[model samples]
Target: MSDLPSPHDWVKRSAQSLKVERLEAFFSGHAFDAHKHDTYAIGRTLSGVQRFRYRGVSKNSLPGETMILHPDVEHDGHAGSASGFRYQMLYISPALVQQVLHGKPLPFFKDGVSHDPRLSAATAALLNSMEDELDPLEEDDSLYGLVTTLQAVCGYNQAHGTTHDYAAAALAREYIDDCIEQAITLDDLAKCAGRDRWSLSKDFRAYFGTSPHRYMTMRRLDRVKAAVFAGRTLVDASVEAGFFDQSHMTRHFKKAFGISPSRWCLSLGE
Candidate 1:
């Protein structure tokens, strides 16, 4: 009859892709150190109290409440009560959100937690159990709904007098995808996009919600994940993914997903 988590902490990762990573985890005490992510972290607490520090304030997300952490924001997490907390989270690349909003600014939730039923409904499909595999179309529809619902909840307004070179950004993104396993630079992306380096950098962020460098890095991480999932050793996978070594890849992996590659693999019982 206790709500407390067991002595051991555990995480279960579901099927993931370059665009989204999903996991369900339980923690009894301190869960994460101060860290920032380049992708939006969105989730719902399933039991007990999920506590975190965001934007200089402490917040708690109870069961059925949604927590939204914007990209590149510093935060830390822990359980707010003796009972600990269990939650399901999805890390979504900003580029996917751009696919729906088309170069708009990413939505922000100042409070870091939401009690809105609409947001919960929108995330339901994508937040299903780790054992369930979402159909491709179903996932896409859920993503669209989530993005639009976020905008609605935030009262998003279209900014005027701002323009982005979507063509250039798209060209740069394509080049990154094609050469993800190679060393890339701003100059390289600029040439590929037919624009100057600085301007292209700005445009890339405007359209994709992240810098060209970050985008390339995430793509490389995606490669690393795939190779590892296919049974390759960490060193081999890191090298094949264009990382200098396993340690190099591990740092980025932890920052991006809040868990190391080894832990992530173990979570899936692999």
Candidate 2:
């Protein structure tokens, strides 16, 4: 941990995408305002004791342990020791977790940092090299593993009441694949699956790690990639995958993939 200024104003910045952020402060005497995020804060503390008030319970995370904060949960963070805290965080979306869980309802972890070693290894693998370029196959595999472990380790124990609901999330996954090429709206999808858009969206993100729209973007990217490999132009491939144009595809392509689509396509030639 870097030496924290004795009396500090805490500031954290997103390193690359909103899906993750890096904290580089020792908020020894400072307190974070209570706020909620749209994504899960799944991460590990690098050093010092990271203290936070979560779901009305106080939990302290230290080195070698993982913390999984559910989305929209009220929480606050500060140092739990004199040396302060440094941690790497991945703001996972519910859809991402759901994808790994094989469309199970987003699992609920205990309201604190965890000592589970499986949690550490699984979450670490994806968020560790946030900036490294990933092959498509690697991205899918890693995300699948991460999501599944998170659900298994962190899932709500009282699933008896909502077992049917969880089943719906599973059915939603099958629904999505069949309708991938269609111009499907949230309302349309919810109606088709007998789910509310909000729940469906949450389930989708928890399982897939991206919004339904972005998931579609990725699916389209996959199709575009195959087309490019078969000697199609970017414009044609984009159109074939239901993208507006090459530029529309490019923006999402880079954000979802961490690289330009052209680069990925060129690599096929190589």
Candidate 3:
């Protein structure tokens, strides 16, 4: 219907290694082609009924309900009503979940949807409008809260393992933070933390929710964003931020943030 809002229009926001993909869209009919990705697709229906197929079962996500599609699962989306559906979703990496759970099995929502109030509240914080900007500390708090809520809602109990070396991971994290612009290596991190390379890698993921490389990538991405905000060209920003080229930066930018640098700049309406 001409009067129906087009779902093709959407906006997204994301950062570097944390890679929390946020989207707000309105779909009047069929959406995707039953594809799958390596991130958890969690969302809340904002208006109308969202119908979709998940794990070979037809399901409907009504307003105020949470939709949790696990990583690498096949799914498709469509509107359940003529009125269409508007929603906000966050595509979170399972690695981030592992950070909180310490390498436990990923949580599964059997029905692919839920009415859990804790999930609703937790998702709401991270799934805020695409226009919102979350500072680093605020983002950390929100991410921890969300992952904890998800663990509870999914009925997962974290397994106790050989304790991770927090001191080593923290030292490496600090080193990365200090030398963010340089191309860092696993050996560099291991030496900095006084641990073996593989062990430090595991420890870094356990403590920080991402790999050391991803962490550095995100830090460079932060610099790119700052440069753009301060009125630098994406080209200059990408180079100054330590990317090989604008195209290389663009690829990572889109992959991490779910939007091109040009589109993101336009969203600022400058």
Which model scores highest in TM-score?
1
Question: What's the lDDT for all of these models?
Answer: 0.83, 0.65, 0.75
Stretches off by above 4 angstroms in model 2 are 1-28, 130-136, 155-270
Put down candidate 1 lDDT per residue, 221-249, tens digits, no spaces: 88887887799988999999999999999
Local error of candidate 1 at residue 270 (angstroms): 8.0
Q: Which regions of candidate 1 deviate over 4 angstroms?
A: 1-7, 16-19, 158-160
lDDT of 2 by residue, 144-168 (tens): 7766776677655643544335555
- The total of clashing pairs for model 2 equals 21
Backbone clashes, candidate 1 = 0
C-alpha TM-score for every candidate = 0.88, 0.54, 0.63
Off by over 4 Å in 3: 1-43, 48-62, 67-85, 89-113, 125-148, 154-162
| lDDT value, candidate 2, whole model | 0.65
Model 3, range 1-270, lDDT digits (tens) per residue?
A: 122224354544444324576767766676544655456788999999999888999999999899998765678778899888888888776656767776555677778999899999898888764576777787778889988888788885445765567778878878987887688889998998899998988877655556778777766877898899799999999999989999988777655544567766765532
Q: Is candidate 1 or candidate 3 better by lDDT?
A: 1
